[model samples]
Target: MKTRSMYKAERTSLNRLPDPVLETILCLLPTKEAVRTSILSREWRYKWTHIPKLRFELRDTTSELTSDIETAMNAMDMYDVYRVLLLHRGPIHELTLYFDHYWEHYEAFECDQIILHLLRNHTLNKLTLFGLYETEDIWYKLPASVFALHHLTDLHLCTFDIDHPSIFNGFGSLQKLVLSYVKISTKTLLHLLSNCPSLNTLDLHIDDYEHVDNCTINELLKCLPLIEHLTISGDVSQWLVLDSVPQELPTLIHLKYLCLNQYCISGDYGSAFLLALIKCSPNLEHAHLEMEYLLEFSVVKDKYSDVWLAHLNTLDLCFCSSSLEIEFVKFMLARSPKLKKVSILTVVDRKQDAKMVKTLLRAPRASRGVKICTWK
Candidate 1:
């Protein structure tokens, strides 16, 4: 009697839910763990395919599996991954697959095939592929199959080379994109941006080899109009400047949060163009600008008269001490009628930050609500 009761209890816990509800619960687990649910009974044999989100990731951690990834072990893992993609029936809403550095070049091909097959058959909405290559210059090229998944709304590719796509179409659905260390040319980059018409949040990582040619930084801003939050960083993009403001701009009028880190500001095209961009962003509420090195300012003809940032409320600037940056602080305090808070951080050692704060406190006039602060 005791043995029978224990057996009944075990079955009750495992097979308590309806098939649809059980599949939904299992989908919350990683793909590897989700597949194991089939061991419960014949009823769950292929139920894992009903999961809408499939994720598989292996990292180079101190785990025992990473320590002994033999050829047989890799083959088994790849087989399981392929089987999951091949059997999945419903529309996959998201896929996150990261290949550890332990895998060799040959293994990447298998993974690529699985990715292509998954994207082709399913209405995949979000995809993240992190190819942590063990060897340099051994980047997994994205297949032409990815472009057709028009339902895709988010994409993230890390350390992948998108050298020559077979064709460029079936895009413009993505609203959030993150490309970290992707090898794409300027032309291809622009084309990609043009496709994402409603891009509101962008995190772009530019390499020393990739840059915009026909468009300078200012002109490139025109490509993204709906951007409310932006982060532009990396070595090559640091020194980029605005050659000329466009005849007309699809400006960042609605942009409210902006961050520019490690970006070089040349005096000639830097100061005015930045001010012009800020003026265009009338609804901008928060801004953080970092200047890497002091640069000369060249006089550009005014693109717009009566510069006003009526909606700006907070501004943060960090850089080595300079009179120009201070002038910018004073400029903001005077122009932004709704300003309330400002922060200035100087990279200089033993500099008079408190004194600078006092100076800004005294020189500012337009907004009485503004509270100026400085950091060393």
Candidate 2:
């Protein structure tokens, strides 16, 4: 007869599971919770160290912390992040560090140290870094060590600044790059894009700041030769046409989707820029345009009469019911032969809204299967 305690321990032991199975369970839990499992038993002490992905976020804790408590909490949180990184085994494939707006005391040196630790293993392919939203003065300038991760394929950065180094080599394997509210000069932006030859998707919504004199649209367009999906928002749309509406741009043969949010269509430059981009993206399938300001004049149809959206299936237009917008809508209705769905979001009274709906319903259509939906 065997001892009862020994039999129970043997029957319920997690040590019986294979290391791969244990790591799989740890991966399913939150990174914080996964680390806490170290206290469960001796066998689990180092199991979480082998877990590949780590996500550490400083959530808003202002509501719950007093002055002294907040300081201690911040210190503890910072220590936990470093402790996990120092003790972790194997290569970390993905890492996310998000500092909430309430975390105002975070230092740039701390961010640099974290990046340095990540540099120990080149297995990191996907990385996301979000800086504090309120602290514009404190920017985490990307160091040269960041570009050393040649295996990086996806990168998302927010509220950071980029200073192009003289000896820099680009992320050769990068495919998707997203920069939101980032502050980078035109020279640096072009340098970053030119080197990312494998880049196919880009979402750029730069912060509103005075740009350099050399920010020309023609050169910028040339860098994104293989871009498949692009989202441009805020003042960046205006910057692209600061010099003049480009007469010719390299045809974006791979571009299938384009979303322009907070886009300026008010002046000749704005309208011409919009038309020029559409003309170059002949294979565009989905176009989403959210106008920022009311247009001063209707888009001259003759400028883009030869352009036909042969593969377009979806068109989403968010604009007031202005004559300029109506004219653009009419032109799209005539040109898109394969269009399947059109969604319009606008602000209008009941009477004018009905009239606008009737106008679009009566507009000549190249696609018989197209369904038009509208909302206020």
After superposition on all CA atoms, what RMSD does each candidate show versus the true structure?
A: 5.1, 4.6
Q: Which consecutive 10 residues in model 2 have the weakest lDDT in total?
A: 69-78
Best by TM-score: 2
Tens-place lDDT digits, model 2, residues 148-185: 67778899988877776687788899999998888787
Evaluate model 2: give its lDDT: 0.77
- Kindly report which residue stretches of model 2 are placed more than 4 angstroms away from their true locations once superposed: 1-30, 39-45, 59-76, 101-106, 134-138, 296-299
What is the C-alpha lDDT profile of model 1 across 1-376, one tens digit per residue? Answer: 5797897677777677787788778778778778877786676777887888888775433324544545224323566677777777777888887776635534456655766787667778898888763455656666555666677788887877664464767367788888776777766777788778878878877543633344466546767888887776664333344565443445687688877664534445556556666766778889888764664422432444466787888888887657766666676777788888888778765546766776788765633867776677
